[model samples]
Target: MFKLLLLCLALLPAFAGAQEDSDWIEYRDAYRQMIWFEKYGKPKQFLQNHFRIRPRDKSVPTDGLRLTLNGKATHVALPLDALGRAVFPFSKAAYDDNAELAVNRKAGQLKSGAWVSIVTRPDGVYAAADLRTACDQLLAYLRYSGEAAGKSCAGVQFSYPKNDVSQVQFHAAGGAVTMLAPKEGPAFSGDAVTTFRVFVYRFAALPETGQVVTSSTPLAIAALLE
Candidate 1:
């Protein structure tokens, strides 16, 4: 019986490590099908948003992005100030106040805070300085995959003027994306069609070692462009 007790004590470290590995949970929005990660039941990444579709009903708020978090509908407005600057409503304080951390503990990706980027183009005839237009050039890249030279490389790239923030380019690729826009023309099109492509770059980095991690299926995203 003493030997049995000793064996249990020896395995305690491994059991605790496994539990820590499984601490995170994924939450996905059903309406747009975007995924987010949480650690200890709080959002690790800021909320993701997009505006490629304008509902026929004018009653709906199409000027900003709306999401359903924890059974409650939350909105984040995309506004451009009079000085022609971008305005995001989700400040750290605002997020803390409204986030539904305990609501959907069972949902999202397997990890916390995914690195991603998005590309959008205009579809309708609104003012050029409108919220949607202001956000057209918003680009974010949080992860780095070190497979740019490989045949199967998948990543995002863009070019912008030194001072101009309004004019920019956006693109997606199955391999290393070199250009700012699609080269082979758009695969899909419509009279009221605006394209918003999201790229989920697969990358991993060791904080202690500073080594690059590459994924076989690195680039992925479910674009709710319809």
Candidate 2:
């Protein structure tokens, strides 16, 4: 368990090496999907792109999973957050060399995808309006890209690390507070892993009266679809 935590939060340059070609999570494919967000000329200030990797089999455990880049000249460990996602490192050097992603503590055949989430604040404080704007931004991008046809931003879900015990709260004006209860839910709406403690703060459930604050940092914050 401790080892898994290390891998989840491992910093850049933590581990680097080559792996078998059979484990090819190709860099080109990741780059293509990731580059769109980088080149997108739309408003997505509140959203960030992450490359997510999960086991193809639902039962496979992903704890302590680590991703690495292996190339003739480029070798490095990609820092993965609690969600088994890494900020898609847009490296020209790795691209030119055609590097591929390798995994440590292999869980089996893996599938990869791109995810959009709200940019996290180190202070763990979120304004009520800011959360709405972030959700709105994601919905706009999804609609603009022809992904969300009639989707509406219902609320936001805050995903925390495994075994999280902190409370998420909505603080209204004059010290009134609403508890954003946490439950064992998937990291995202359709994510493969579903063991994290996710706090859902639906705008409908609570008025946008106050700011939201977390006792612990969230792994990701995603829009709640309506």
Please, what is the whole-model Cα lDDT of each candidate in the order they appear?
0.21, 0.72
- Ten consecutive residues with minimal summed lDDT in candidate 2? 1-10
Candidate 1 lDDT, tens digit per residue, 50-156?
A: 21122222233323332222313543333432111121222344344443312111222111212222222233111212212222212111111221122221222
Q: For candidate 2, lDDT tens digit of each residue in 34-117?
A: 776777787889988788776665676667777888899888888887677887778888899988887764424566656677
How does model 1 fare in lDDT?
A: 0.21
Q: Mind sharing the TM-score for model 1?
A: 0.20
RMSD over all Cα atoms, model 1: 19.2
What TM-scores do the predictions have? 0.20, 0.84
Error of 1 at 29 (Å): 16
Model 1 stretches astray by more than 4 angstroms: 1-89, 95-98, 101-115, 123-226
Show the lowest summed lDDT stretch of 10 residues, model 1. Answer: 1-10
In model 1, what is the error at residue 189, expressed in angstroms? Answer: 23
